[model samples]
Structure formats: structure tokens, C-alpha cells
Target: MAMNFFDQFDIPYILGTPLVIPALLFPVLMCLTTNRFLKNRHMTIQSWLLNKTTKQLLEPINTIGHKWASMFLTLFLMLILLNTLGLLPYTFTPTTQLSMNMAFAIPAWLMTILVGLRNQPTSSLGHLLPEGTPTPLIPMLVLIETVSLLIRPIALGVRLTANLTAGHLLMQLISTAVLTIMSSMTTTAMMALITLMLLTGLEMAVALIQAYVFVLLLTLYLQENI
Candidate 1:
């Protein structure tokens, strides 16, 4: 019962053996390149989508920051895969975990900060204080700005974790309800089953949107620095 309740969020194991790393890497590894060209229709479609998304994401970023294009695209694909795969039966979604989200968030956030500081120290520090501030409110505004700046990664991680967690929890509750009432309340259960199916479709869209948003935010951060 406990396993059924918490299985969506918890790290899943097979035969009592943990497989966290492999689960996380499976999506990424699936996209690994081969020497031969990808000639299949689906592979070609994927490549086309990748190309289009790359252009859209990099459009906002400056040429100087364009070097991170591959990283951004790969992260986007990995995230989408992870989120989508987790919707399947008896699978784990690492992005649903706050710790895992933070692991990705913090480093990416820090890299942008470091880039800003390294390439343009004055401009980076200048972000803490806006121009033409009144004397009395200077310290207060600076503190507020600094706190906001520092909280980006936390916001990023929590946003991803909360969104995924809520969606999965809702799906689980609806699914369980459907099962519990199916035998006794056939019509009502059928309605619920329809709702669940619709919600599943919505969740799949959310999965893709969240992945794009994550990487897009990262690009925006990098845009500020570069």
C-alpha cells in the first residue's frame, strides 16, 4: 500500500535493487549518436524538431553565448524524455525529486553567475543596485535585489519539482479512485476514466512545456551574462 501511494515520487527499484543513475541516464543515452545517418522517418522528424527548437532557443541569446547551444538542446531533450517517460506505469521521474532538480538547477544557475562575473565584473555587480536610487532606500533595495538574484536556482528547482509532483499526485489519486469505484459504480467510474485520460494528455503537454521552460530560463540567464 505504501509502495503504491509513494511509488511515483520515490526512487524505484527492481527486485529490491536501486537503479537511479541508469534510469536518469536512459533518456539521454537513447539519443546518443551513431556514425550512420538517421534515415528513419521518426528519427528525421526528431532531427527536424531539434533543429527548430535550437533556433528558437538560441534566438534570444547573443552569438557569444551561442557556444552553449548543444548543451541547452541536449538538456531540453533529456528533460522532455524523463518527464514523458515517468508518466508510464511503474516508472520513476527524477525531475519530480527536489534534490535532483536542485542538482541541475544550481550548477546551471551558478555557471551563468560565474560567466557574468568573469566577463563583465562591473556590469554583474551593477545588477545589485539600479541607477538613480534614493540615498535612504539604497541599502534596502540592494538587499532585496541580492536576495532575488540568489534565489533563482531555488525558484527554478522548486518550480520544476512542484509542478511535476502535483501532476503525478493528481494522476495517482484519479487512477486509484477509478480502480476503487469501477466495480461498484460503473458509469461514474467511466466518467472518471475519461477525465483521467484527458488529464494524462494534459500531463504530457505539461511535460514538454516544463522541459522547454527550464532550458529557456537557463538561456535567459546566460543571455544576461553574455
Candidate 2:
């Protein structure tokens, strides 16, 4: 039963092929791409919000980092949409998959590291060690720093996966309890149902927050590189 519950987290497949790609791209398709000067109010408002968010995120970043603003902004929108939409009934969340999250994390993290290495090799390498360090601790500190650096993408993937997975599991457990006790104990079932509703709302907030945190961290990584 527990394994089956967790099996929901697995990527959906159709005829033995993964169906996650289309589900992942669903939000992008929902975005309007008309070239007309005039647009609907919803799309216009969304565009304005997107502009504002991009400005806010890029403001603290360096001018060189501004070049990547569009990419990051798109990523933010993608993540927010995915996270929120996953809560809808019968929808699959690609972000729930570690492989999917790792795919996003590794390349972005790699890009920042590569950019840092290509543009500012000395300064980038300097990040691994601090100044005025004692000679005895140099090797140990460098080793620890290297390990920390290597763990970042893994951290990113795991953080996202763990949060979403926990929320989903909690929701499932509460829902199962509600269903099981619905016939025998009306009072207990009602209370569990109320808690489930509250948790559902909380999960929605977590969804939005996790998305923002993911993008924010990515931008910070970019800031370090640029």
C-alpha cells in the first residue's frame, strides 16, 4: 500500500513511453503568443506581471546577468505554472520527478559554473577558498568546499522533490483517513476533511513558494557567475 502510494510520484507512461514531456510543456502552450498589438485583458495583465517580476529579479543581479533575464523569467513562469497546476485533479507534476528536477538543475548549475570558469577563472576558483586561511586547513577546506560545490545541483533537485513529495503524501494520507472513517465516524471524518481542505490550501502556497525559491536560487547562481 505504501509503495503504491509513492508510485503516484513516478512519471506517467503511455505504451511504455514516458508521457511527462507533454504534461511538462502544457503550461507553455497555455501562454498566449499572438503578435497583435491589441490583446485580451488577462494576457495583458499577465504580461505586465511578467515584466514586473523580471525587473525585480534582475535588479539585484549584475548588468551581465541581465542578458539571461528572459531565460530565468521564463523558467520562473514555467515552474510556477507547473507547481500550481499539479494540484489540480488528475494532473501530473513533472517537477515531482527527481530526474526531471535534476535535468533542470544540473544544466543550469553547469551553465553558471562554465560561465564563471570561462569568463573569470581566477575569481571563480577563488570561491572555493577564503583568504587568510591557515596552511594546515587549506587542503581540508578546499576538499570541503569542492564537496559543497558538487552537491549544489543535487541539493536543488532533492529540495524540490522532497517538499512536493511530502505535501502530496500528507494529502494522500489525510484523504485516505477521511475515506476510511467516513462511514463509521461522522465527527472524525468531518475533522479530517477540514484538515485536508486546510492542507490543500497550504500545499498551494508551498507550490508557489517552491517555484519562486527554485528560480531565485538559479538567479543567485547566475549572479555569482556573472
Candidate 3:
């Protein structure tokens, strides 16, 4: 079969084979784990928060950290798994696509708004319009907030898709160059092979760092809205 950089994007999947299955499982797994953890200690949600560090940071969040963390970890795993899978021969990286990245990020952005609304029904919109602005500035503040809110998913999707796509493209270019050199000069091929090896290692690191960045930003967004 002919191989090319774009060919990896053609991965086929059944209805349930997409990343959403694991994405949904993430929260379920977290809930089960949290319940077991709590049951083992015989602690109520209130006592759990008063006792645990994760819960403590989530204190201002109306105890939503436990739930959000579950989702965050799920997203983290799905991204990490998808990124790492791309490293394997003949596998596709879902994260390299704008649709998939947006799928992951849009929910996170919406969750921030939902959490804000649930926690502060009266003042959630006020978050966009900070207190003590001049009457004339209300329109400007609303516009600014609207723009800022809209940017969250766009930024998240672009950052992740760009990083993963760039890394894979670089790897493909280096590998193709190595193969081309191997057909001509043995020494040059060896050098290209080493470079490719190093690039592979760096790609692995990028995979992890990108996942962490995605989760960290999601957490920060949650913190801000809650």
C-alpha cells in the first residue's frame, strides 16, 4: 500500500469505537473510585472535603472539584491515549483533528459556564461584567466577556490540534528523509536514523506535556468560573 502523511487521517471506526466511549468511561471510573475511597473511610462528602487536599482546593467550587476532576482526568487519559496511539505505526491520532479537539474542549468550556450558573445563578453573568464598572461601560464589558467566553474552546482546540499535527508531520518528514537517504548514502542514512530516533523520543515527551497542558487549562477555567 502507498503511504503518506495524510493517509493516517483515514482511520476507520465503528459507531462506538471513537474516543467518546473512553471519554464517557472516565467520569464513571472516577465516580466509582471516589465512592470506594469515601466508603473505605466512612466519610461523607462534607467530611471528605474537610479532610482531603483535592476537596480543599475545590472548596470555593461548591464541592464540584471531585466531579470536575473526574472529567478532567478522563479528558487527560483520552488525549494521552489518542496521542500515544498516533506514535504507533499505522494508527491515527484523533487529537490531530480540529473536530476531535473541539469535541474534547467544547464540553470543558461549557462545563465551566454550567458550573458557574449552578453555583451562582444570580451572579454568574456578573462574572463577565465585574462589579463597579461605570454604567456606560456595561455594553463594552458584556462584549468583552462574550468574546473571552467564545475564545476558550477555540484556543483549546487549536493549541492541541496544532501541536499534535505538527509533531506527527515532523516525524513523517524525518522518516521519509531517512528512507530516501538509505537508498543513496549509508552514512547519511545512519545519521538520519539517529535524528529520527531522537525526534521520536521528543515526540513522546510532547505527547505527555500536551496532555498535561490541556488538563491544567481545563482546571484553571473551572477555577475561574466556579
Candidate 4:
């Protein structure tokens, strides 16, 4: 008997061995690059999409910030691919892991903060204290803002994990219910299966959208810093 539906989201192992890293790397294998480009249709499409997305992301940034665009674009592509891959049956979703998401969020967020501090120290520190604050409230406001600033990475990690976890949980429940009742109730099972299919489509969209949201927020943070 199954202990819980949550187990489905557990990091899968093979033959008593943990597969945390391998599972994460598996999705990346899907988009193998072609050194010579035009020989492969998928490579061509991926390159085109990446270039277009990169342009859109970096278009608003100053010339100096343009250098970071490639890194961000690559991150976005990896994230979207992983998110979409997690929607597949019997696969683990790495973004659902808080630690993994934090690993990504913290360093990136910290780097941005460092960039801001390095480039425009005054403007960066000013973020911790809003403009036009009254004397009495200044100390309290600074503390609050400082706390918020530090929590940005936590927010980023939790946002990705929670969204992916919730979607996976919902899908698992619906699919399990559909399976459990299928033998006894054909019509009900069929309806539930149809709903499950539609819900899956939504989840796929969520995966892509969440990736975009993650990258977009990071870009905004970079904008402030740079």
C-alpha cells in the first residue's frame, strides 16, 4: 500500500542509490547542441528561440548590463526545460526541491546585490531606506526594508518550489483518483481522466510561466543593481 501521495514527489532512486543529481541532469540531455547548427532542425529552432528571448530580456537594460543577458537567457531555457520535463509521468521535479531552488536563487541574488553595491553603492543602500521618510519612522523602516531585501532569495526559491509542488500534488491526486475508480465506474473515470488531461495542459503552461516569472524577477533585480 502507498503511504502518501507526497511520496511521488520524493527524489527518486535506482537500485538503492539516490539520483538527485542524475535526475536534474537528465532533462538537460534533451537539448543537445549541434556544433554546426544548420544540420539539425531542433538545434536551429532552439538557437532561434534563445536568441529571440535573449533580445527581449536585455532590450531594456543599459549597455553594461547587456553582458549578463546570455547567462540569464541560458538559465531561463534550462529552467523551462526542467519544469516541463517534471510534468512527465514517473519523473522527479528538481525545482520542487527547496534546497535546489535556493542554491540557484541565493548565489544569483547575492551576485546581483554585489554588482549593485560595487557599481552604485549609494543607490543600492538607498534601497534599504526609502526616500522621504520621517525621522521617527526611519529606523523601523530601514530594519523592515533590510529584512525584506535579505528575504528576496528565500522568496524566489519558495515561489518556484511551492508552485511546482502544488501543481505536481494536484496532478498526482487527480490521476490516482482516476485510476482507483476506473474499474468500478467507467463513465465517472472517463470524465475524471478528461479533466486530468486538461489539468495537465494547464500544468505545462504553469511550468513555462513559472520559469519566465523566475527569470523575469531576476532580470528586474539585475536592473536595479546595474
Candidate 5:
């Protein structure tokens, strides 16, 4: 069975749908984990940084592990699962959709802004503006900053969607070509199978790499703004 991109768009829920479920669930799970970690008796931000012993080092990682750790793990697992699931004989990957990717990216961008606002309400504006600049340059700077901020979500969404979409399409094309060649000779079937195996491995790596890139960028944004 071939997967249809549009089929994934069909609404499966009353309020929204399953198409958005993974995106929604990822953040929710992250938040819950973060809250639980924060409530732990041994997990405090101070303890995380100051403890230098091997066991204590592990404690610190476990302490604040909920905050960014939740986000990182959620993003990684979700992307990998979605990507691998799509590679199954016949299944659609939600990450391949722009809407789904946007759902993830928008939250990330918003979280970046939220962290900035929460940590530095007064200086947050300064992020968009240089400390010293001529009056005329201020307008240009504002325009540039606005565009840059707007691009964050767009870039994030496009990167994930494009990579997944392209990879799947490429795999499909390769499979088609292999099948065509296999029809002419029996030996070609082995070659085709090998090609498919290689492609599958590459796709798996791509899935992990994309997830890591997204999470890394998100963490950098939060660190910068916060």
C-alpha cells in the first residue's frame, strides 16, 4: 500500500485530530517530566551544578534532568519513531507534513520567547536592538530583528518537513527504479534489496540527525534568550 500525503490530513478528533497528536503530546510529556523532576527531593538547580563527585555528578544530571532533558528526549524519540514508522511497508509520517512540523516549531519558538520574557523582561527588547546605533539604523534594525524572529519558526518547520519529505520521496523513487531493473534480471533483485537496506540505514541516521539538530538549536535559543 502506498501512503497518501493528504490522507494524513483527515481529521480524527473532535477538537483537532491525530495529525497534531504527536506534536501536542511531545510537549505535554516534557512538561510533566520537568515538573516531576523539579519536585524531587535531591533534584535542585544548585545541586546540579555544585556536586562534583561521580555519584553527585549523576545526581545533578538527574536533578534538573527534567527541564531540557525532557524536551530533548521527547523530540528525539518522537522524530525517530515517526520516521521509522513511515519506513514500514505502508505508513505515513506525521513529521513529513508542514502543519505537523509547524506545530512543533511554533511551540519551540514561543518557548524561546517565553523564556526570554520570563528571565529578562526588561532586556528582552534589547535582543532585537543593538546597544548603540544611529536613529536611522534603529528602524532598519527593528525590521531585521522582526524578520529574524519570524524566520525562526519558519526555518524550524521547513527544515524538518523538507528533510523527511525529501528523504521519503527519494526512497520511493529508488525503490521504483530498483523494481523496474529487477524485472529484467534475477540478479538485480539482490542489488535492489541491498540498495533498499542502505537507504533504510541512511534514513534512520537522517531521522536522528534531524531530531538532534532541532533540539540543539532549540536549546541554544533558550540559553541565549534566558
Candidate 6:
């Protein structure tokens, strides 16, 4: 029963090995391989989306960090694909797993910190204590800020994992209830079914928004450093 309820978040295995690599690669492999003068509707829509999203995401970023734009865009694409694809029947949502989210969060967070330290050591370290901090309160404030700084990656991973997991669990519970009561309470089952449909739509939007938020937060962190 436990397995049945949470199995959607589990990493699937093909024979012996986990299937995460292939799942992650799927979005990357789906992108256009070559540029052509002529484009189909699918290609045209894809290009338009790419351009619009890139502009929107990069507008807040500074010129120095523009080089990382491709990396950020690729990560966002992977996240959105994984999230939305998992909504389909018989699929797993990787972001629902804390470990996977942490894996992405830690490295990205660490990279931004490293950039700040390398580019402007004094300014980066200066963030530990705000200007005009009272003498006695300085230590306490610094301690608080340090802890907060260290918690950023944890917050990022937990935010993604918690949001996705909560949505999936709610959907599962609603569907289960709908199934359980369908034979006896037809009207109630219909209501539950409608709610489930609405919730699914909301989850789709959450998936996209979370992907954007993840990349946007990373960009914000980079902006602080650059």
C-alpha cells in the first residue's frame, strides 16, 4: 500500500540500472539539431517560445552573467519537461524526490557562491553583516546571516520537492477517493472527479511556474555575485 501510494516518485529501473539519465536526456535530445530556413508549425512555435522565454528570463540579468544564459535555459527546459511529462499516466516525477532536487540545487548554489567569492571577495564577505550593525548585535546578526546564507540551497531543494510532492499526493488521494466512492456515490464521485481535473490543471501550471522560479532564483543569486 505504501509502495502503491508513493510509487510515482520512485526512480524506475530498467533491468538493473536507474532510468534517470535517459529521462534527463530526453528533453535535450528533443531540441532541433540544425537550423533551416524553412520551418514547420511545430518548429516555428518552438522557436518563438525559446526566443520569448529567453528574453524574459535574461532581461533582469546583468551582462557579465549573460554567458550562463544557455545553461540556465537548458536547466529550465529539463525541469519543465520532467515536471510536465510526469503528469502523464505511468510516469515518474523526479523533482518530487528531495535527493534529485538537492543535487541540482547544491551545485548551482555553490557555483554562484564561488563566482561571488572569486569576482569580489570583499563584497561577498561583506554580506555577512549589514552596514551600521550595532556593536553588540554584530555577532548575532552575522551568525543569523551566515545561517541564512547556508540555508539557501536547502530551501531551494525543499521548495521544489515539497511543492511537487504535495501536488502529486493530493491528486493521488483525490483519485483514490473518487474510485472508492464511485460505485456507491455516483454524484459525489463525479464532483471529486471534476475537482481532480481542476487540480491536474493547476499542477501543470505549478510545474511550469516552479521551473521558472528555480531558474529565476538561480539568476537572482548570480546577479548578487556578478
- Candidate with top TM-score is 1
Minimal lDDT window, size 10, model 4: 30-39
lDDT tens digits by residue: candidate 5, 1-226: 3465334434345455453465446545744665544546556753453333223212324333336655555565566666566676645576787887788889877987887788788777787888888898999998999899879989988998888877877777667767777768758776777887898899988887887677667766666665
RMSD of each: 1.8, 1.7, 6.6, 1.9, 7.8, 1.8
Error of 1 at 120 (Å): 0.7
Structure candidate 5, residue pairs in collision: none
lDDT ranking, best first: 6, 1, 2, 4, 3, 5
TM-score of candidate 6 relative to the true fold: 0.93
| Number of clashing residue pairs, candidate 6 | 0
User: The CA-based lDDT of model 1 is what?
Assistant: 0.88
lDDT of 2 by residue, 136-218 (tens): 99999999999999999999999998999899989989999999999999899999999999999999999988888887888
Better of 2 and 5 by lDDT: 2
Candidate 5 local distance difference test against the native: 0.68
- For model 2, name the residue pairs that clash: none
Q: lDDT: which candidate is best?
A: 6
- Model 3, residue pairs in steric clash: none
In candidate 6, how many Å is residue 20 off?
2.8
Per residue, candidate 6 scores C-alpha lDDT tens digits across 116-190 of 999998999899999998999999999999999999999999999999998999899999999999999999999
lDDT of each: 0.88, 0.86, 0.74, 0.85, 0.68, 0.90
Give the poorly placed runs of model 3, Cα more than 4 Å off.
1-4, 12-64, 131-136
lDDT of 2 at 169: 85
Query: Candidate 5 clash total?
Result: 0
* 140: Cα error in model 4, Å: 0.9
Residue 5, candidate 4: how far off, in angstroms? 0.5
The stretch of ten residues in a row with the least summed lDDT in candidate 2 is 27-36
